[model samples]
Target: MGHPKFPSKHYDTPSHPWQKVRIEQEAGLIHQYGLKNKREIWKANTKVREMRRQARKLTANSSDEQFQKEKNLLLAKLNRLGMLDENAGLEDVLRMTPESFLERRLQTQVYLQGLSSTVRQARQLIVHGHISIDGAVARVPGILVTRPQEKSISYSPASALNSDLHPVRPGIQETFEDEVEGKTQDNEKVKGESEDNAKTDAKTDSKKDKETETDKEEEKK
Candidate 1:
């Protein structure tokens, strides 16, 4: 076993570091999911790669008894992570992408559940111990959340965010309709404010130009 202080790397770096397309894709994922770094993306990629490899193996040995056992195990694991349906098979596993893994992360679940306004906020809330699952604080933002655990995700009991009155907490909605209505109202309010400001600025600029023209005309006289 390795030293407890220095654990083995859980992820692999890209084989070709200078691949522009891969780099851009990873950057987009990182921004979308609020990942700490490319290492997180690499970790998800490695996990998906391993699952796909197993899927391919099971596909090749589909007629074997041992293959059935192993295939069931893999499918069960993926289902628990909410990455597959009850009737999904090896084909679905082979189709899995790093995004499938990323979507099951605790931070992503938190954001999807509306516990935070953004994925970045979800990560921050988790890291700061404001987020919880089944009433227990979960400090790891990237931990793979299970289907059952996803339902239990919420504010930690001790966290200030548990209080609905907390300033930092995003607006909570009881239904999808309410969430959409809230967002729509906020957008309209922001748009109205922006238009008002633009009109005020235009008026100020016009008055300044008039003043400049009057000053020039007076000097000529």
Candidate 2:
């Protein structure tokens, strides 16, 4: 991919009014991919442009084997990302863009993997060193996980140890349910105690009133 010539500032609009629709598209990509900035999208665009450039170059000769080789490489990469299926064809590779490449990233895939609650959380978990892939610690949120490796993704035992039921722990949600039930029981107990206290106070007041009335009668006599 060519080195991006653009500045690092976040772009709200493309400067040209004709590119106004791009702002919406860019924002959607950022939200959907959980990107940190618009620069990332631009970076992906350049990267895809480079890939397309390579494809165009390789196919300039128009040899069958060259085309197949390029297709295979793209397929392998995409399959590693868990995007393309087992029966994907060369036509699919032609349709592959940088967005397709980005979608396969570890952060996005992990979110789609249903490990973390959201895309950003998946990225955070990865960057925070809370996640692992293929039984090896993978701290890079941008790591593109293969389908087989995706199965291997798991939480660090330490990270899993102490927390309210986060998405990382399936067992923790059940524990949370138990905790809620316990709280409900505790609340019922408190209510019962409060009712008992009210009854006792009422009885005491009644007794005191009767005693006062008797004292008044005695005084009168």
Each model's TM-score, in the order given? Answer: 0.77, 0.60
TM-score for candidate 1: 0.77
CA shift of 44, model 2, Å: 2.3
How many residue pairs collide in each prediction?
0, 0
True-structure RMSD for candidate 1: 7.9
Full-model lDDT, candidate 1? 0.92
Candidate 2 segments exceeding 4 Å error: 1-18, 64-71, 86-90, 161-221
Local distance difference test values of all predictions, in order: 0.92, 0.73
The best candidate by TM-score is 1
lDDT per residue for candidate 2 within 33-131, as digits (tens), equals 898877777766665666566656655645678676876786677676666776876556556665876776888877776677678878888888787
